[model samples]
Target chain A: MSSQAFTGGHKASHQELPPEFQDQEESIKITGFWMFIVTDVLIFASLFATYAVFVNRIASGPTPAQVFQLNTALIETLILLTSSFTIGIAIWAMRQNRQRMVTWWLVLTVLLGMAFVSIELTEFAGDVAAGWGWHTSAFLSAFFLLVAAHGTHVTMGIIWAVALLFQLRRRGLTTVTRRKLYTFSLYWHFLDIMWVFIFTVVYLGGRLI
Target chain B: MHGGDEQHETAIEPGFDFISPRFEEPKFPMHQVWGYAASLVLTFAALWMTVNRIMSPSVLLGVVLAMAVGQAALQLGVFMHVRESRGPAWHLVPLGLAFAIGIGLVGMSAWIMLFKSGVS
Candidate 1:
């Protein structure tokens, strides 16, 4: 079936699969990664549910309106969005066999991701300094937990990207490296999608309500 | 050069013919460009609505949420290549189930918290 699928395409050639899907094993691994992403969806969904329940539980603390800075959120959104784009381009470059371009774009992605984390940390620090820490109210607690979870993910992604950069430098664009890069891109894009929800439901919706 | 080598290698193998142009994948990366533009438009539109107070809170919330979902679709379809799979694509089965379960988790939790009782 796999061979037929490879040959069935009109462009059937010796290389039937993309670099990332070059092997049946690699293809299955990508599918497994998707499953992992589904579980992550559930984790975030539960957090969203918790936030919804506590969004109104201010309890004599700073409200969402007072806390969320639209300009900052917008900037963060743009940064992450642009980083996602760069990573996509990186994968595209990798497919084109442009190893240097891939490394450069990946580095850019890591930088932008770092900027996002720093901005998020600044926001959290400001809140805590203003006596609006998570302990102040249920709303604040939910807010902190949800946003922090995302921030932690971004931090880890930066680390992962750096590691991938080293691998790309050392190994070039072999199938194994390509598969890893592809999965990393998927993970990065998934995080951006999650941020869309966070910006909408938490930051924007907080102010709207 | 690598592609030519692959074709030669496969030609020697039994039951394999030289790949035709019809089977060739498109070389352009236009999908990524389209996804990026769509994402930017959706993001700015949601931000504009929130900043300008263009609608009631409830209406704006619904619109923004809808836009978020659309953005996700664009990302999955274009950037993530979510449909690119090998074999029978059993992964999508679990993915579909996950989506249903996620929606149920969020929806039921919100309902229970907001309404206090399903029977009520």
Candidate 2:
């Protein structure tokens, strides 16, 4: 597979690179995205620390055992885990140059993400309606902030994937499009990993403790 | 056709072939399949542990934390292709630094908050 075959370029070496790493510029961009993920990891870590500190401070508010629903958390976990799997398959399809398959998998991923967000929002609404708002306690505040930040990221991911779908329809599987999709998959997977911790430390731990 | 084949053969310089192995694409999505299966198993295991009340709180936390770390590693290695950089992989240094800082931030915060001056 040479760049000449795909793009009719004179230089053959360009085609040798993968679609995501098609050149020095794209390669650097991928590395930079990795760094961005690292920063995001630290941000989540700080939030997790804050949550740990205030986890016991109920201040006459609802405890985690009272507010958290295992069934809802489990459903959200399954949806997100499925989305992560679909996004992986989407990237795999991208590497195989199957544009339609990639697009559909990404579409599935976005739908699953939307489901997760909807469920999360509903849970929050229930909490607030029950008068367990963030202002009620430090524990609730930290919990809301951590979970909402993740929800915000997933919302952004859905928007990004939809935009990429349009790009894929217009441009096909060019180097630029491929790199963007690849980075998007990385971001999605990172969020899934964060969710793993959130479920374990927040929901399950809260119930157990 | 023979001449074109010869040209194609010669176009790939000697040293370039050393890196050509990676260019060979796989026919199946085996890695993704395995990653998905492993992640599902880990998720269910943690859920079952918590749901069944199979262990004490401290033990359950340790087991769940280990599973969380394992799931993250699976995503990074199999799904994210964390090592599939195009160059010398300078990106890893910053990633390592970030993890260090993250652990320090979490641990130090807990220590600072948990340990306070005593006033009897």
- Candidate 1: global Cα-lDDT? 0.81
C-alpha lDDT of all candidate models, in order: 0.81, 0.83
- lDDT (10s digit) by residue, model 1, range A1-209: 13134334643443666755656567668878988998998899999989988888899998899999999999999999999999988887776777898999999999999999999999999999999999999999999999999999899889989999999889988878889898999999999999999999999998788
Candidate 2 Cα errors over 4 Å, as ranges? A2-15, B1-25, B116-120
What's model 2's interface RMSD, roughly to a tenth of an angstrom?
6.9
RMSD of 1: 6.7
TM-score of chain A of 1: 0.93
lDDT of 2 by residue, A1-209 (tens): 53223332223344454767656577678988998999999999999999988988899998899999988999999999899999998987777788899999999999999999999999999999999999999999999999999999999999999999999999999889999998999999999999999998999888777
Candidate 2 colliding pairs:
A2-A15, A3-A15
Residue-level lDDT of model 1, residues B1-120, one tens digit each, is 233233442222333322112222335667788789899999999999898989899889989999999998888777886656543345666776877887788778766776765642
Candidate 1 at A25: error in angstroms?
A: 2.1
Please give the TM-score that candidate 1 achieves against the real structure. 0.87
The TM-score measured for candidate 2 stands at 0.87
